[model samples]
Target: MLVPTAAGTPAAPAGSPADTAPSVSASTAVAQARSTEVEEQLARDPGRFRVLTGDRPTGALHLGHLLATLDNRVRLQDAGVDVVLVVADYQVITDRDDAGDLPAVVREVVLDYLAAGIDPARSTVFTHSAVPALNQLLLPFLSLVSVAELERNPTVKAEAVDAERRQGRGMSGLLFTYPVHQAADILFCRANLVPVGQDQLPHLETTRTVARRFNQRYAPTTGYFPEPEALLTPSLTVLGDDGAKMSKSRGNALELRASEDETVRFFRRARTDSERHITYEPERRPEVANLLRIGAHLAGTTPGELADAVGAAGAGRLKTVVTEAVVEGLRPLRERRAALAADGPAVVRDVLARGNARANEIADRTLADVRELMGTMYS
Candidate 1:
């Protein structure tokens, strides 16, 4: 039986239709009402709904990252929502053997964000290591959660397995407890909304659980943290040239900063079946379908329409079409990135510095409140 969050009449056993009907109906009504309430709250003042989203900054941002998150972040910023983009620099060490010039990597990631239209004036972009309050929040959050609970997080488990395979070693204790750190990331900013894909629902649920537990234990009557709601976005699983998930480590990803010539060359070499005619059958022709999906995403059209447009054409023609669309679409972004690069590291540093100062101010207030509640504040 699914446990309820609030005190309510217990759900009847499955056999009794007469008793179960009202309970089911009431449960549905309550769920709908709560959803409506959240919607109203968001609609009333979009700016009041603080959104926290970020990347690990392990590598340069790629096209997959753009569609998966950066685009949505730009939309949210334009809609006047307070956006906090965390550069999760600390997480880069979780599975890797070497940090590898992290400062340079972080700078490149910031430039990619600016190139992809993330306006620094509108969104706060700060590094995770810049904020000391996060550490304080993380310690208490760790106590609230358990070893078993951390071990049970599906995301962490899957990542650990993958890390083990790559590193040929067991996961570190820090990697095991990364979810608790993520919870602190969200709650420290008091973020009310987090944009995530479906697969990330488990991570968000962990964050919600941490928030709820803290509020209940420390400030039962007046909640200190808002249990963040997941703002589900359309999943964009852009495959690499080899028909696997696009990843920097695999060297199959099309970086956001790829030059026009590089974009053309990469897609030209993308694997496609020996079919004489073009078609959109992802199950059987994933490589060709991957090209089609990339074109659709770039051209703002459906894969079916693209298939019809390229009907009876060979894979070479399809590649040509896809490459042109991708290159043309990315031209403006490339120009912007080039301009930002010409300005040097000073601009990126300034943007991050301002963001860090502002974020620290907000985080300090929240940490102060938390300390007062926990009786750690003595003046």
Candidate 2:
């Protein structure tokens, strides 16, 4: 049996209808409606929504994180939504065998979060391993999905290829089922809103599928899980100094934790066209526009305005403006981060402890509900 959910997708039985695999255009239209609805609801009653979003601790966060999602995470939290930030430590090994500097990287991630204004009091910041019950939800979630559906996920396919390339071996089973793990993360808290970029819509779709199927099969009347809606990020993609997506591994990223001198050095080596006339034409002049966008973000103005302000000054003057903006804008965060770093791991440990405690509480309750619904509450 199948029923249409509020999101306009049919809640067919798992693997049935092949999900009817709506065409890209159809799915995008549905997603657009949901996004609009979510925004409207947020404007009226933001507190009613819970947001789940995070990053892996595989690398330090960079400018892209700031412009894309971290800033918005703070905005949503301040707007009274319950924000749950997960440091996906377990996922670090999905591709690589050893993240040898796990402790250091996790600490760095926490530091970045704190520095980025993710108040530990307002948000729950937890790691994956600390809450075993969360991962336990995976088994049931996995059952609600299928191998073919997992294979069909474009994000999974891309990551799997990248993983194999990095490891020089076939993708791991964990990598194949990564979207399901992400589903567990979302539904564990029953988060109804997830902030994501365009490329991540497919992963969010998988979460919605598992949530819908689980409710239909296990708790039809109750609708135990929310079909999470994507709060599509409005920020433009922050490109690298080299005109591509900012990436730390590629050495094109300007990390949030970088020293002022480092920031200057990065822009110093940045690529820009020879045109002395400055303008914010991302499509035609991506290199120059990348710098302008970054500057505009820091200066609290539009890229075009920044460009006009620097009109005829050329790339040299533009880089200097951006460099100064970055340094001055990041000053307070750097100070806060330095203070946090000085306390050793005390602050990080405390944040994780509180966050993990709350996560376990929520996860246990959700797990119990699932067991009761499935008639598996043996205890």
Candidate 3:
């Protein structure tokens, strides 16, 4: 769902059916209502700190991924979190069948970050392929870590089972070894904070374990790895037109690149129950529940307020309110994307160049420490 935060931005799709306008019970029907005020407030706060978060460019970022990597990124950046967008191009090859597309995919992800308003100046963004030292850390760390330990990691098991279901076999070594590499990604830069949804806590825990293990093995007295901490996101956003947890493989995801018409069409067709009365019972009314959730999120009002307005309203009335909220929510984002896309592909390249250099700089420090400790050739 588009979260409209820009002012004077057109929210309702121009082609939206006339009847889909917000009803009296619903507020903020501006379709393109400005809501960045909240983020602006957070940005002005002095206490907000830095963050390192990103994605592996396995596919185009759908709405689900955007909320994590882009929307939350914009909010945190505004909240003064020093953000680093990581393009895990190397991780895409974890299970193979995608080695050739990594470069373009990296550029594509970088563009998405830029389009999403991640200011390169406020945040440093980098690609995994560019940081050879970071990747090298994975090898030695893997030796310190054991196969049995890897198997126990939650993300590993989840992906392994998922891969097995889809490919009729378990995911490969890269997929299996991904958790350790992730540990390196966080620890190499000495990142102290990662923003993560609740379900992703386990993934971040692995980073914590690795930091503890490495510090115990090498710097037990002084401590290294920083034992990165989690911001522990309060809520999660769902995707897929079906209102299920959005995923690329599910074919239910809406891409950031989707057009206004596409966005409208996508939401209009989203799965909702046949029971006409629009209510905000998440457990009871998943379809209407999804719409209510989107509306509440965008309107900055509690879901209870939405349910009150929607009380006894049939599906048609509920659709009008939800559609309006969604349209208003996305309009500013569309404008921002249009402006950023005009900057052209070269912009992404420069961000990558600068980010990669910064990453190498950090990775070099860790690599140096480890080499000296192990009495390597360079040391």
Candidate 4:
């Protein structure tokens, strides 16, 4: 039997409602519902299922993040979709006004992805520096999304207002305009699906908005910018040990590259209450509940099963179990990374070559359509 979590606690994980499978017929009755669910989950895109997603090269990816981006990237590739992972090396300047680690950061970030099972051959992972035309598309998109619109953007507001309130460098124009670059990233390749977290819906919304407006204004009225649909990830909002958002800058992230020693230390410092038992109750036992959740995820069992396995050990032992599970879980990543980083420069170059070739072929067609719509078509 599952040990009781603290009383009155909720069971919903982030991005997951209490509802899992709704009571509905899987026959004719559910066809519309299923279709809508799919369209809502993915854009009812008639074009290719190419998925475009990228990261700002500010830091390394953590396990909490791997549960979202890296894993999803691999899944989309297996489904026969063209997947492009963009290394937003240019946008690093938005958060910090420095160029100190630009090349090093890009190199490290690429190696981290390779280590994390982001295959360069099966999927195209390339740095922004390698693709110049992508940035060029930004000029047009910038003209579409207004400053007021960008200001109202929840992400920019969170970064600039909420974060800057703590006395860091305030948000810059580049950060506010990062979405334009993102639109360029997707539309440059005419991507059809973009996988992202819930928080970035506004950014993706802006991407779609830019595509619509740009195609209306510049592309063939039939459209050049494929209004990219979002492939909403199932899990998001993975909490830090502190019970807040997970981020490297917040000092709240545990990197995928963390040594076993490092993983053990981080989990040990994770906050918990005076409650003496281990439970999966998130509402009442949020801190400990999150630990159990992560452990369940890495250990390949339900929280209920893990609770039973760690039976009666309470929070201290639960932490130990989670710590060990994470270390073992990430060992493959560490080893694969070591092998790749030995020839890191070559690996990055090859990824870029493949991505550029694929991206350019699509970009050329999209641009031609844009010129035709804008009446600049070279007859």
Candidate 5:
């Protein structure tokens, strides 16, 4: 039994609609107020700050991705943030045994970005492999951090263990040192802010450490790289149907581009307990709670509110409601995706090419400055 917060709210059990409603209203109001504050903050001088965020091109974007980070990116862009969205094609091979259909996967990722409301004209969207300077910066960045330091990164260790468990083998050297490469990705663009979830704080800290060390060693008078800060999102942890963290390989993800039938089938098959009543007791009933969270996110309300609205409705009714809300919420995105897909790959290629050119120009200037700082700019 998870204890409630300072608000004296307990977990809504099977027959406690009265206790749940006020808590729901209070939580929803707080969340709304905080969101408004963030929006107000972003609206002021977003153009002065450079923000970099991205995803590994392992597959298309999913509902979890949208709730966790993509939505924040869109908001930032709309508020005039200088946004650079990276499709990390190179990182796909870091832990995986195989890079599956790299080109097709990358293109699909871009389409998903476009569908998710990332305007290419507003936000620079480029593939990691297309930016040569990013790779070039990695050599020097790697030298700044030690093997022990790399091995100690919690994100790298967790990812390596998961990969080895899946593949039944050990990870490669590249997988172990991937965080250093990530540092290069951030510093190369001189991005001042990186939007990330709480679980990714360790990686962002590593990036900050690398930036600080590089500046102190090379250019103490004036810092060459900005010590990028993590813009931690409030709703970062989105669980999958199995009550575990949402991931593509788990086969529990709700893909953003999933068909109407597929979406229905996915939610219909969601795992809930034998107890019929829908309640918001995550610690005790995670599967059903996960569905409630998804539904609340889609319906623009709190999970407690959603549960109260359903009253004593059983799991079947809850599932139906969640499925409808998800389908309806994703309708516009799906329509946009279909229209973009119909335009074929040429349009996506053009967007990527233009973004790549812009990224290259900025990266080149940064690299030139780094070389000059290190006294390696002979020509």
Candidate 6:
């Protein structure tokens, strides 16, 4: 059975949320209910909602991205929602100033999106740098949020701590206001639905706060900005081979670009318990359970079922099954990516060019509305 950690106690292991105590707060429950309502509304009339979600171009795409946001993005796009994907290239500097491989990483990210079924024709894909009007919303949005509120944001706090620990540098000012920037990303396009996990609720809440404050202050009756709703995703943490959060920098992740042989070798070396009898015990046997979870995700079954299938077969058999499942599951993506990559980065550039053009048109209109609302539209 899962146990809750006491106050001041260490956090539960990654991917084992049930082992941690539940807050069970009324506000949280309300948010969940609202998310459910938005989800149902979206299903009935997807044309009514616009979704804004993206990733920072830190590295190659991994399985973690697949199970988390990428798949959800595709699902939403297929449902006929207006999906706007931002390659958060500018946010990468919030932690480090490394632009050496930024361009390459951005191209790879676009390639990954295409390979994962985010049709360029159906969904808009653009970069942060290309959208100046979007960033302009930052100044006003920043004013809407106080320093205390920004600092209080758990996502910003955790990211700042992570950056300091990993890079041995203090958090950048941009990093401090990262949530506000995200608010801009969502509000600039007037996106009404944002796909987020529990950890990201703080950021989305901040966005909603900005929208509410702006409407109350300037566009009172107009309600110029829609307070975006969170489309909370099913929580399924995909840990790395080292039994921690799957990360590209940690070298424990299985990249979507990994070859079949690489996939096998990587999973073969995954950290697993020595017990010959396999069991799906996330609390006690996190690593084993993590593998089971990955295998089950790819095999379209529950982790318990995968564990039962691998019972007494040992970690070797389990690893083999998971690795093969991954290879088979990712075969189509790899093939499509290979074909897309053969065309070089030009194709991605063209897609971004088109996306940026479309985004600029939308941003210009949004900014015009903002200026008129604030009585600053002299032009």
Q: What TM-score would each prediction reach against the true structure?
A: 0.87, 0.93, 0.81, 0.81, 0.86, 0.90
lDDT of 2 by residue, 1-379 (tens): 1111342333456556535567777777767777777777887888778999998998889988898888899889888999999999999988777877998999998999999899999999999999999999999899988888898899677876676667457787888889999999998988888998667888988998888888778776656787888887774777787778898678789889999999999899888998999999988998888889888888899999999999998999999999998899888888999999999999999999999999999999989988998999777
lDDT of 1 by residue, 1-379 (tens): 2111221223223244522223334634443454456556656667667889999988999989987888889878888888999999999888777999999999999999999888889899999999999767888898877787787787677876786677458787778999888998888888878887656766766776776766666776656777677676766788887778999999889999988888888887788888878888888888888889889878889887898899887888889989988988888888999999999999899999999998899889989988998889999
State the C-alpha lDDT per candidate.
0.81, 0.86, 0.69, 0.70, 0.78, 0.85
**lDDT of candidate 4 at residue 86, scale 0 to 100:** 85
What is the per-residue lDDT of model 4 for residues 358-379, given as tens digits with 9 covering 90 to 100? 6666666766666666677667
Which of 3 and 4 is ahead in lDDT? 4
Cα deviation of 169, candidate 1, in Å: 3.1
lDDT of 6 by residue, 76-95 (tens): 99999999999999998886
RMSD (Cα, Å) for all candidates, in order, is: 6.0, 3.2, 13.7, 10.2, 11.2, 8.4
Off by over 4 Å in 1: 1-45, 159-168
The positional error of residue 157 in candidate 4, measured at the CA in angstroms, is 2.9
RMSD of 2: 3.2
Error of 6 at 321 (Å): 0.9
The most accurate candidate by lDDT is: 2
Q: Is candidate 3 or candidate 6 better by TM-score?
A: 6
Which stretches of candidate 3 lie above 4 Å from their native place? Answer: 1-49, 162-170, 235-237, 377-379
Model 3 clashing residue pairs (backbone): 3-329, 4-329, 11-31, 11-32, 31-328, 32-328, 43-78, 50-82, 240-252
**Top TM-score model:** 2
